[model samples]
Target: MLGEMHDVLHEFPDLKDKINELHDNDAEFAKLMDTHDQLDDKIRGLEEHEQPVSDFHMEDLKKQRALLKDQIYDILRGLS
Candidate 1:
């Protein structure tokens, strides 16, 4: 979990420091944490499936990813 989280933070360096700071530190973290956790789990599940998925399914995942990213951004903005 920590390794994957590190890779995610490294991939998006802008959020790297902020995420480190939020590693169980903030009181307002619960709501944002839920969205983050759910998205991460869904992404992992989709990626780990043995069979290949259709383009349509890929598109759906992308949309969900975008929504999750937006939610994360909104939470960060609110904190700021």
Candidate 2:
């Protein structure tokens, strides 16, 4: 789990083109991506020891990351 990749592009490789399209043209989508990226970086930093975080806090961060991923997936699905 520590080394797992959660970047939207990697998580949804099949939707790469659509993801890029929306990220470029949709302000909301772009914002979501920015938030997701920030969360991901935070999680990674915690896991990799770049940042210190309690286990409970890390779990909460993982949950938030998953929720954002689901929201992004829903948008991608709607585009299909």
Candidate 3:
């Protein structure tokens, strides 16, 4: 999944640039970044669990996913 994420950014360097461009001042981007960090931490925490039932982590992931979708939509809108 991380590889896929990297591929998306690599495949669309312009979009990545757009994101980086907005990182400094955009509240959405800041929130997205924070969500991404939380998702990463939660995922890492769950990784070592033998039988993890991570409903709360799943919710965090869902929120991050929605934020990502919004960010992508905003980027596409910018392109248009």
Please list the C-alpha lDDT of all candidates, in the order they appear. 0.58, 0.85, 0.56
Is 1 or 3 the stronger prediction by TM-score? 1
TM-score of 3: 0.48
Writing each residue's lDDT as its tens digit, candidate 2 over 1-80 gives: 78577889888898899999999999999988879988998788777875767789888988998988888888888942
Itemize residue pairs with steric clashes in candidate 3.
Answer: none
Winner by lDDT between candidate 3 and candidate 1 = 1
Q: How many clashing pairs per prediction, in order?
A: 0, 0, 0
TM-score for candidate 2, please give it.
Answer: 0.89
Per-residue lDDT tens digits of candidate 1, residues 1-80? 31143123443578767766765687555455556566666656666653477879856865775665665666656744
The worst-scoring run of ten residues by lDDT in candidate 2 lies at: 45-54
Give all TM-scores, in the order shown: 0.52, 0.89, 0.48
Runs off by more than 4 Å, candidate 2: none
Worst 10 residues of 1 by lDDT: 1-10
| Residue 32 local lDDT, model 3 | 64
Q: For residue 1, what is the lDDT in candidate 3?
A: 43
